[model samples]
Target: MWVYFLLVIAILAWGAHLAWRWKQARDFAPQLLALRQQEGELPPSVSQKEFTDLYLRAEGPRAGTYVYACAAFMTVTLAPVSSLFNSVWTAIWQATGSDPVFEVGTFIHTFSFFLAVMGLTILILAIAMRRYYALMPPNLRQVIRHLKDAHS
Candidate 1:
């Protein structure tokens, strides 16, 4: 019961955090545009599409931090989420007074295990890529970027 309560609290906290971030981003957009205009990074009277493209170009690379945070959070929360799901399913089963065709706990455990594995894999890949990029020579990196642009 305490675990269930804690899980609910954690979920609500995460949702609130996400909402706060979304609001922050929303508030920052116009400011970012204005700043870019002042810095001559963007022309005055830019269209929405042009602003979007510029914003993505400027901010997209930094998204890896968010991805890594999410992956780590997912990996950390695996046990709690699995426990919550199994508890909920067990309560429902007891209320129903009927045997389930398959063991819900087993499925929940397996699903959570796979989710953790995926999260770990993402974290590992991100770390490896970051290290590889950091170690690469600047000239080589620039060449790779040019090749990527040509392909695009």
Candidate 2:
């Protein structure tokens, strides 16, 4: 069905995006470490928490974009997944003479429904976090600007 096709495409696109992000992170790691160790910046022996804080500050408002994107993706794909699972359940019911109490299709449908609820929750949380971040002070803007300059 068209839903299945769309689901496949969405999955493939997500996989490609993840692969690209992984490649970018792999390439950027050395530069990020070098930037961290530079004079007047974080020391070579910086603690993990300190480094993470610096990185998050450097990312500024854009840090939440990844979470927003993932939540949106889940929101968009949940319906198709649920539909597919429902179709599977129907097919299995038809193939089997009767619907068993502990059928795989029923389990899959329940799991997919649970995932859909979780995805909706995550989407709502992402939206709330985005609004909260938007209202936060602009102190991190300076860190983001400094990191851009250093990268350039």
Candidate 3:
């Protein structure tokens, strides 16, 4: 029951995320094409100003909200495993002691949640990196820069 609930929520979150990504792509089609024409591959992150300008047109906040919700879906699967799974999760945890598998509908819930979490994390990191450039701490920035330079 609880596992099913988590699965449903995660599925919904993924759906929302997909829709938001589609919208972002549609909104940025012109810029996307321009980049492809000039640079070959798309840039990693659009500038914050570019995103902000696009966001201001409408649906920006909604897109951001969807990404955050996706993360919530991921969290729903982990941590305490959800109170809804008290009986099963507790029993399994007790039996296995930290090797608990999600009860019943867990596979779907776990996949959806984990995927959503990754997607949300990517969106946030992209946005932050786009605007702040080096906000992910100096060490991380240096590593990324080194890798990027190496790639180039």
Candidate lDDT scores, in order, read: 0.57, 0.59, 0.52
- What does candidate 2's lDDT look like per residue over 1-152, in tens digits? 78857776776676667656655655554566566567545445544454446554443334444554565566577677677767776777668775575355467557866776687777677777787677654454455455555545
Q: Mind giving the per-residue lDDT tens digits that candidate 3 earns over 10-107? A: 76777677677767755665564355435634345544354334433333344455455545544554445444445554566567655435443467
Candidate 2 vs candidate 3, lDDT winner: 2
Comparing 1 with 3 on lDDT, the higher-scoring candidate is 1
Q: Per-residue lDDT tens digits of candidate 1, residues 1-152?
A: 68856766766676667666655655565676677558755556555554444444343333444544565566467678667767766777677784664356467546765675686667766776786566543342343344335434
Clashes of 2: 0
Lowest lDDT 10-residue stretch of candidate 3: 135-144
Candidate 1: worst 10 consecutive residues by lDDT?
A: 138-147
Residue 151 local lDDT, model 3: 41
Give every collision pair in model 1.
Answer: none
- Show model 3 residue runs off by greater than 4 Å: 34-152
* Of candidates 3 and 2, the better by TM-score: 2
**Candidate 2 segments exceeding 4 Å error:** 47-152
TM-score of each: 0.39, 0.37, 0.25
User: Which model is ahead, 1 or 2, in terms of TM-score?
Assistant: 1
Which candidate should be chosen as best, given lDDT against the real structure? 2
